[model samples]
Target: MKEIIAIIVFCLALIKGEINSEILIVSENNCHQVFDKDQGQITSLGYPTFSSSNSSCTYVIKAKKGQVISLQWKDFNLPAGHDRLCHGSSDSVVVYDGRQIGINNLYTPMCGNHSFDITSSGNMMTVVLSSTSDEFDIMSFYRGFKAAYKSMSHHCKNMIYKTGYGAIASPHFPMAYPANLDCVYTIKLNQDRVMLLEFAEFALKPVKGNNNKMAMDDCDDYVEVYEGAISQRNRYFRHCGYYKPHPITTGGNIVHIKLHSAKSQLALYTGFRAFYYSGVPNKCGLFYGTPSGALTIPVIPQTSGINVECQFTIKSPQVAYYRVRWLSFGQDLFKKGCDENNYIEIYNGFYDKKDKLLAKKCDTKLDEFDTQYNEMLVRFKIEKFNPSRNFKFIYIGVTNNTVKVITDKNQTCTAKTTIVYRYSGPEVISREVKCELFSIGGLPFWASLLIVCGAGGGGLGAISVAFCLIRRRIRARRRYRRFERSDSEGSL
Candidate 1:
């Protein structure tokens, strides 16, 4: 009699297409494997044409640090709930944000046929699919799902870059930035390398004061630069305005930049575009035998801080004179006077209050001067905020025998040649041109050279000369347009 009852129950299960040989446990080996180095895929236990039975499967995805996991579903088909009692029918998928499964970290419980994506905030994610035997129906035999998971780096906020020479911008830059946005970027470079930051474009909502005049002292939306890793104590500068600030350089291997926007401002915000790279650090103080060296504010445009001072004292051999040449000089100019704000001052001797002041300059004009004494002191001071203000100069120890001055052709106009002469050796010539100048209308410089060379049958030297001329002409036209824009803006 018992055997007859068992056979009848087995027949009913067969008719319902329910496989009830204990729950189907898809172990880690049975489930799809997701390696940390590669993306992976997951599907229903019997996928494509899965059976309706009591079964459970779990898929785990992992990634290395500084990476996050993202899951995208291509197809999802399961029983749908008609009411609260059958929210996801008996078949459902539960996603957890991390490795450990807990009710608090449940991302979502999904069912039915739909496509969606979910990204984990950390390096791990867990997905579990379960079906109950009580709800098994022959019609649900086609229920199945498909998903893919991959590793990706964080964007928009709290980013870290290990390599060099990349861009960092306000989130959704070149568009109206989001309101109440806060982001931080930490740049790490090789040992002994420093950071160089240049702004290609910048625009932020200006704060207005009395009479609707633009206020410079206060800012509601601002970007802060730090010398080392980001910290409250390491704050370098805070900037906010329509005026584009100058390029900046860090003194160490790490640079942290923070961007913030206020809640009130929502539109007409064309954020900012900035590039960063690793470069050599600045040198200061006395030198023994290094023949020729350059010194400048480690950071350009001097936008990092206020009430800042940088001084360098150069001492040559007793018989040699310290010669200084300004490669490029720029500073904040006050209509009233030069000394009211940022300026560079040269002292005849080791920097002293009693020493003679050779010159007090605060403009872009180029200048060359030498110190009367064997020791020379150069000082740069910034008493207030100034955008895009900086100075670069080169110095060498010269005696009566090594007094020859080699003129730089690029000094008068933007040329591509640099001539250097050593006191003990022959002259060294170096030609350098901006890489952008070589490309004309998206064509490589070599291609243009080849076309011109092939058409004219000119020598290699002539081909080189022709290429330079063409590049120079194109650069001149670009400079003309830029000058015109500058003039128009000045008039406004």
Candidate 2:
């Protein structure tokens, strides 16, 4: 009972402090990022946004008692000339005036592309961005991430730009290159205080054939959205030396793309870029291919279950170790069985120097059905998970079935996987099942009389016992009176 009371008190305290751990991106005139509490509730101070050209942004994420609290800049922009004091004062009350956290001094120099990391105590987030190149100086901070940026070189100068998905390039630069380039950029969140997720390198390749076209929007020209720019129509088109496209948001993540050429497979290569951030690193820039030559790969991030990326036919039963840069909690890789209906799970120990491996028991059979209803999807929820920990599931042999669960580790697992089974069948019919127990029959007033008579008889028995006691007492009294009268007569 006392523990329950403590938990309640703790939660109340957390809610009051405005501490939150969510990474929320809201679309507004001023592009805003809100870190919400666990229940999706916004704090009183509200979410934060870019205030001005020189304004800096400060984010406070913490859990007090038991509730998540978040406080950000609702007022004021980053104070110019005083870039060193961007995080605000120690006792600063959260508000929108010139007092809240502002954008760092890098807005004008670096074009507002700033990144940093800090511990819960605020002692670790002490990095100053004074110049344009300093923003990219974070390469050392993100040691585990792939550290390359893709751009169209001068070699490609005269090719028609085709808007598609994934990476699609031409022999030369896009004749409509300004309209076709789209790229995806991913930022990995490192919550582990000790070990940080490192990015080695990433490669950008051109999508083959018509696959790239499908990734573009319905419009003939492709438009990109980025940080300051939220929408396609409102985007500021910049094509100075290299065409810098905007980023897109889908399924609650940010993506950037560029369609530089119509036919040349120009790829951006970034070596190992590693760093530690607040959340897990699951986001990546995806270049889509056209529908005619679509990659048809699973687009969801793996949070749990089995994610299998393998070839169907293999002669030798060879065992080769697959190493993902890192796997925090709620993420795993799996192999597909006969088709997408079956899978095998795998995980490598993140902490063990020896790298101990464990595999979860297999699911013998999975029901295959496809529909547009809620119950048709499989949901997996993991709460209070650390990304550094790894768990594994075994696959007896390889088949053609596989599935992946993609969700944030810190948030409740609640990651749902919906399987689409393609088959020709009759339309499903709905029917109701009903059960009737027993019915009552009408009784006459005689039944009521019987109940009343039984109650009356019980009352009479009680009254009879009382009357007998009274009579006995009266008889005794009369005997005593007679004895007294006789005694008086004798005396006379």
TM-score of every candidate = 0.31, 0.19
The candidate that achieves the highest lDDT relative to the unseen native structure: 1
Q: Tell me how far the alpha carbon of residue 186 in candidate 1 is from the true structure, in angstroms, after superposition.
A: 1.2
Candidate 2: count the clashes.
103
Candidate 1 per-residue C-alpha lDDT over 1-492 given as tens digits, one digit per residue, 9 for 90 to 100 = 665664565556545765433324344466544456558787776454444456667778888765667677877877766652347477777777667786535544677663346655457778887777544443334437888878877666767755444555576554677888788877777754665565656777667742123443477787776656465434545666664544454445677778788887658877775666455553332232233345554443333555556676656442245566565544343333466446678888675675488877756666676776557767777554343454555554443233333333331234454333222222336655433434435577787656656665556668679879999999999999999998989962
TM-score of candidate 2 relative to the true fold: 0.19
Candidate 1, superposed: residue stretches over 4 Å from native: 1-151, 209-217, 229-233, 282-353, 356-492
**Model 1 lDDT at residue 270:** 76
In candidate 1, list every pair of residues with a backbone clash.
none
In the range 320-427, model 2's lDDT, one tens digit per residue, is: 111111111223212222234333222232322223323222332322211111111111222222232122211111111112222322221233332221111111
Residue 167, model 2, lDDT: 22
